[model samples]
Target: MYAAVVRSYQESPKFEAIDLPEPSGAHDAVVDVLAAGLHPRVRSQADGSHYASRGELPLVPGIDGVGRLPDGRTVYFAAPDTAFGSMAERTVIDVRLSVPLPEGADPVQIAAAMNPAMSSWVALRRRIAFRPGQSVLVLGATGNSGQMAVRIAKLLGAGRVIGAGRDPERLRALRAIGADETVSLAGDPETAARRVGEAAAEVDVVLDYLWGKPAELAMVPLLKRRSDRSRALTWIQIGSVAGPEAAVPSAALRSANFRLLGSGQGSVTTAGYMAELPALVDAIADGRLSVNAVPVPLADVADVWGTPAGAGQRIVFVPTRGAGA
Candidate 1:
């Protein structure tokens, strides 16, 4: 079975085919690959720069995928924290880690949407105490997680959803995906903040994906303008796409009454996921949540991973040609 194996952690590691990996334990079931989700974190893992790097070579780098077991169970999983990932024709995963897909669902779409959707779901529903009718400002709104955040915020009854990104066209697309307003970060931080302030002053919640000076700067004034001190503005920091180090003034917190929180898959317990997965899956199956997935063959995985696409659109790698549903 062909798999994308990284021989070394160089600036540009070679992704090529290698021998199929065997299942290690009885609890680990081998999945017949169907589709895999490509994220920026996968590239970072390949380059030995990801936060969870084990410094191991010849790693299979993919974080999420949809596949089938020997008994013909269709499943999708958020890849475990290991070098043995989902970027292979056959890969092993613990049975508990895999979620069985609903019957007649699109495999590529499910694979693409799972990671981003889960990130948004976990961040909004679990990490932050998101209340209905609260206004939400989603930073980096054009990206995968940001777009999911926008949709999830709206579905969960956010009063107003504002999406902020660098691109105008992408911002327009965000509006179609449940964003009531879109703000471009092309201008200075003050300018961006003022623009957002004009639209909706004192946002109740902020879901921040891009960290760094710009994100920090843009959020500072917005946080300062919160209507009530004890009303509680929440900022959930999920990713650092812009840059890791952010310069934020401590003085801004006086009036904001904000709760800055970090959210990710690792933060949640296995038992928590068992309870949450059912509701999330039900939402997907019922069409309450939607994902924009671009289906590509597994052979084109490298090309798709090479460039950054729109934030809202997900790239799903389908292993079996002419396979759908």
Candidate 2:
């Protein structure tokens, strides 16, 4: 079968013919991959940078995809056990990692949205002990996960949802999706941080995606402006697309009544994720959650592989269907 073979961490994957692996465990099953998303996790996996890193090279480079069984039942699958991943004509999937999609659900959209969407969904519903009507600030809100955070916070009964990001136009547009206010992170660090701090002062929870300089900027001013001291503020770190290290203020931790924690893989257990998946999928099917996606053919992936999927539209690779067909 043809797959996107990644031989080295420094290189892009090549679409080539490769030997497919047979299932080793009774729970494993092969599925015809219909569509797969080029999520950040997939890229990290390919380069052996993700937390759940699979360094065994000469491997297929996808973490999750929409696939169909021999009986034609469509399912959204994750984490191929063979270490070859989901970017292929066929891949091995553990049955426990697969979820049945809703009728009329767009496979490409589900493929595109699920991973990013899952971060905030699980964080809001499970990672933190959430209370309805609390205020929220979604740091780096222009990203895919950040956008989802704003909407999901509202769906879960947030009173005010503030979105802060580097893009002005995109941040402003977040209002349509339930962001009560938006702050621009485009200026100098101090200025942007001040704006982020101003917006964040009253929020009860923060779903942070960017954690580098931006986080540092926000933290400094946040310490000065914080007002809610009735309860501990929950700051859940979800993504580090901005940068991995933040020169956080010592006073911010010393003075503020807040708890900082990460929300993905290691922090949230497999059982916690599984418990939230059904509700998250239900929200998508019921139209409470929606993903804007464009389908690209697997053959054309070489051209668009490392291209960024901005908040506007995520790209989904259709293995069987031609690009945009």
Candidate 3:
């Protein structure tokens, strides 16, 4: 079988012929790869930068993808952190982690949207007790997952959604996709913080993707502007795109009724993620949650590995079929 093999953390994944691993676990089965997304998570996995990376080399880099099982069912499956990922003609998958796609669901679209969409979808559903009509603020709202967070918050019944990002054009574009208001995080820090405070001071929830200095700085101003400091504010750390560590203000935590927590692999259990998958899959399949995606041949993985996808467009790799057929 052929796969995008990563031999070093410093180099791009090359499409090369490799032997497929036989299933060893009770739930494991080799499935035909249909579409795999080139997500930031996948990039980090390939480069050995993700916290989950075990520094293992000579591996295939893909977290999750759409695949066809031996039983002929098309399902979306999440791959374990093994040498053989879902980037090949065939890869091992835990059958229990997969869910069958609804009739007429587009595999490419599902591949492109699921991972990014899952970040916010799972966070809102499993991380917090979110209710309809509550206001939301999405930090780093210009990125792929952040953009989806804006829409998901609205779909989940957020009364008002505020989007803040460093891209002025992208921030402006957020209003069309259910953001009640948008703030530009570009330019002078003081000015940007003030705008964020004014726009999202009273929001009930914040889905923060930028956690470094940007998130650290935004907190104080946002907390100060709140009309009622005693009101509950839930801040869910979804991604650390800006930076990992933040010198959080001790005063900020003590000043208001602020509750901070993370939402990801360890934070949300496997059962928790599985429980939310069905509803989320149905939403993406039915077009309730939409994403812009483009399909590229898996053979071109190495060439496009370092290239960034166009604004708001995710790249989904389509491997040549029949190898696993």
lDDT of 2 at 92: 87
lDDT score at residue 325, model 3, on the 0-100 scale = 34
Global lDDT for candidate 2? 0.82
| TM-scores of all predicted structures | 0.90, 0.94, 0.98
- Residue 78 CA displacement from its true place in model 3, Å: 0.6
Sorting all predicted structures by TM-score, with the top scorer first, yields 3, 2, 1
- Measured by TM-score, the strongest candidate is 3
lDDT, candidate 3, 97-136, per-residue tens: 9999999999999999999999999999999999999999
Q: Model 1, 199-267: lDDT tens per residue?
A: 545678878889887667765667555566577777788889889878667866665676777776568
Task: Give lDDT for model 3.
Answer: 0.91
